[model samples]
Target chain A: MNHVTDLPLWVAWLVAAFLFIGAGLTLTGSFGLYRLSSFYDRIHAPTLGTSWGTAAIVLASIIYFSALQSRPVFHEILIGIFVTITTPVTFMLLGRAALYRDRSENNPEVPAMDLPKDILDKLKLADKTESVYLESGERE
Target chain B: MSATILLWAITFAQIMLAIAMVLALARMIKGPRAQDRVLGLDTLYVNSMLLILVFGIRTGNTLYFEVSLIIGILGFVATVALAKFLMRGEVIE
Candidate 1:
């Protein structure tokens, strides 16, 4: 509150801009979280916030504080790094968990683990082709 | 001129983040299933962390940075454990 004015002309504007963008992205992600139709679709929503949203705000903080205090304030980068790394892990695990739950419950809407006939046929064809290539090489 | 703009911007940002948190809360409470609830909780955690960071910026305190970082760590651990629980009936096995 007291120190915000101490920031120079350009720094103030930069910080303000970054903060606004970050907040907007986060809000939009939450809206997606609320509006999306399915759990799987909803899983993709928060990534907007965790990715650029976190990065923008942290960048603003770094710029504002580093300039204000006359030294680089870099610890915020640690948070950015941590968020970027962990978000994927959590989301992946959550998605897999939901899929496992759905499969266990025998939910018909979910496609069976067994591939469709077309894909299975393609794989079988490929297997046969590989065996034929091996036999041809042996004959040569 | 810029000071007032900056103040207004900070206030605006805070309001937006608060709205995001509320939306996340709504999803968490209105969940059709456990996974949705867990996802909502995760989003809520991230929104709150952002809110705290904004608060830190408003007050010009570095301490909020540390607080936000800790919140991030806790949220990740919590989400992972909850997700694991969802996958298996038990956690840690």
Candidate 2:
């Protein structure tokens, strides 16, 4: 707590503001996760936290540490970069997985496959609205 | 004073993050599908990581930076693996 006073007033204010915004966004995101009606809708919620929610807090951290240490501490950038690069990969994978599962179960809400009719017949999926094509690829 | 303001702000932020984590947990527990649960778990990992970073800022310690970074990496790996498992019915196959 003693070290808290060593921070200048303006820096303190800036950090506080960033903290509030970041935390608020994160809370909203999580609340969305809890309240969303479907898996696909819920999937979009956490990105709010992973994106700007993380950026705000990391920015605040960079500011606080840089001010406290009297030098530009930039190591926090690694977390930012790693998160930015990895988030899309995870989200894409999750979405694809969900889509695959839904199609396998013959779910009607998901979009239809775009393959030509010949391929759909060869795969024994001509009667189905969507497919388990990816599953067939795996089996073969 | 600025110190008091920052302290209260940090405290409030931490509390909010904790609540966010709980909300995520609720989703995980109430999920009707495995994908929903995995999504909630991913959100939980992210919220927990941010909470750790805020904790670092409060203590003025740089070590927590490494800890949070590791948490992020682990979360990414865990989510990816879980997603793969969902897709293939096996993580390594």
Candidate 3:
């Protein structure tokens, strides 16, 4: 640890508070991951940590460094942005892969991959109605 | 006055994160399937990165920031690779 005299009291306290909040959010998210039942449900849990959880900590870092250096140090935004974009993509891919494997194995836990023909026809009709409603909403 | 309060809060936060990591590790070790293990690993990586950020705040150093960033990238790649392997039974397929 650096000597205590290096930082002003207020700045130290501010950074510490930010760090605490960020870590708390992260812990909650991870805890959710463990508590949630089923793989698909677990998938949503990490997003809590990846999105706002990562953002809060990065913001804390930016705030701390900028305050200490007396200038804006905003490069930490890169990791924040990278994570925000990549985490969703990874989660989506993993979910899809799991779904595929489950379907291939004919796992009863997962729904059938291809809907019955009647259901597909009904879905198409529903989609058409949805599109028409969307267009009407846009016009209004 | 407030500084002492903030210090106590941060210490509490670190303790929470440590507990979270342990929970994740337990899931990783107890997983019944390969995918579950991979998911645990992913969670572990994200938690560790956040832990590093907290340490950076404690030490007031920008260097730890870089380390955290690198760990994030590495973890992302490793998880993706493992997920791919799970899908195809090979890393490069």
Cα-based RMSD of the predictions, in order? 6.2, 4.8, 8.7
Instruction: List the DockQ of the predictions in order.
Output: 0.70, 0.89, 0.42
TM-score of each: 0.88, 0.90, 0.82
Interface RMSD, model 2, angstroms:
0.6
Tens-digit lDDT string for candidate 1 (B1-93): 667877898899999999999999999999999999999999999999999998988888888988999899999999999999999878887
Off by over 4 Å in 1: A115-140
Fnat, one value per model: 0.83, 0.93, 0.53
Instruction: For model 3, name the residue pairs that clash.
Output: none
Query: Could you tell me how far off, in angstroms, the CA of residue A131 lies in candidate 2 after the best superposition?
Result: 23
Model 2 CA deviation exceeding 4 Å by range: A116-140
lDDT of 2 by residue, B1-93 (tens): 988999999999999999999999999999899999999999999999999999999999999999999999999999999999999999997
DockQ winner, 1 or 3: 1
Residue pairs that clash (backbone atoms under 3 angstroms), model 2: none
Top-down lDDT ranking: 2, 1, 3
Q: How close is candidate 1 to the true structure, as a TM-score?
A: 0.88
TM-score, candidate number 2: 0.90
By lDDT, who's the top model here? 2
**Index of the highest-TM-score prediction:** 2
lDDT of 1: 0.92
